[model samples]
Target: MNEKTVAGYCIRCNDQGYLTDLEQWNREIGLEIAEEENITMTDKHWEVIEYLQNQCKQGVAITIRKVGKSGVVDIKQFYQLFPNGPLKKASKIAGIPKPVSCI
Candidate 1:
């Protein structure tokens, strides 16, 4: 399937057309998104992604949102704080891990 068909969003660039709609989560795309977000190896977002990558490699995978205390919020508040709503791009900047199953 195409990246758009899969992730529902394109990951090629930061623009609209080069962009594909985000469908859902996939490990390959997740890693790509991490790279696109410019997440450094020493950054907090990288820490979370590294943890998640380890877990996934171990067959003990977990979603990103559940790894921290930020999970304790309602939908409205969650989206308000995360306007883009946890895209890997924004998450890396915010120093939070990308949403495990997000597109």
Candidate 2:
């Protein structure tokens, strides 16, 4: 486990930088992570992030196809929102563990 300060809070994270403790996450931390990922948060982006976080809490396996089917955003738009690696980037910003489905 690695500890890093984000949004003035020291949080535990994995080697890949995904937060290890969901309880330690907040919107400010998410914003900082999004900035690090080079993404500017829009309401749409927050919607996706919320969706991802909720799914994670529910123990739902997150996948691009699932997110696409999720009313939040389609696959194309999800890609557009996060660019290079949507699932990985979004999950990171959402303060959830990196999905097993992600490479």
Candidate 3:
């Protein structure tokens, strides 16, 4: 496994930069990851991130369509929030494995 420092913490991660250990994640790490992805965290973004983390904890398969129906954000807004590769970016920031639905 690869390791990188984020928010002054060394975190294990995959080659794609998604954290390998969910337990090693925290708000500061998420913020750093989002910044690396060129995203500025907002309340709505935090809401969506929480939703994704909950879904991941429950072992639910996450997809764009599912997130659209999550009532957190619609598909268009999801794109607006994460731009290119929303699901992948969101999953990374959420400290979960990259969704298989993303390429």
User: What lDDT would each prediction earn against the true structure?
Assistant: 0.40, 0.94, 0.94
Give lDDT: candidate 2, residue 77. Answer: 98
TM-score winner between candidates 2 and 3: 2
lDDT of 3 at 42: 99
Over the full model, what C-alpha lDDT does candidate 3 score relative to the true structure?
Answer: 0.94
Q: Mind sharing the TM-score for model 1?
A: 0.32
For all candidates, the clash counts are 9, 0, 0
Q: Residue by residue across 1-103, what tens digits does model 2's lDDT show?
A: 9999999999999999999989999999999999998999999999999999999999998999999999989999999999998999999999998878436
Give the clashing residue pairs of candidate 2, or none: none
Tens-digit lDDT track of model 1 for 22-60 = 323344555554455443323444444454445444555
lDDT of 1 at 73: 41
TM-score, every prediction: 0.32, 0.95, 0.94
Clashing residue pairs in candidate 1 (N, C-alpha, C atoms within 3 angstroms): 7-22, 7-23, 8-21, 8-22, 8-23, 9-20, 9-21, 9-22, 10-20
Evaluated against the true structure, the overall lDDT of model 1 is 0.40
Best by TM-score: 2
Backbone clash pairs in model 3 (N, Cα, C under 3 Å; residues 3+ apart or in different chains), count? 0
Model 1 ranges with Cα > 4 A deviation: 3-42, 64-66, 69-103
Q: Residue 102's C-alpha lDDT in candidate 1? A: 50
| Model 1 Cα shift for residue 78 (angstroms) | 11
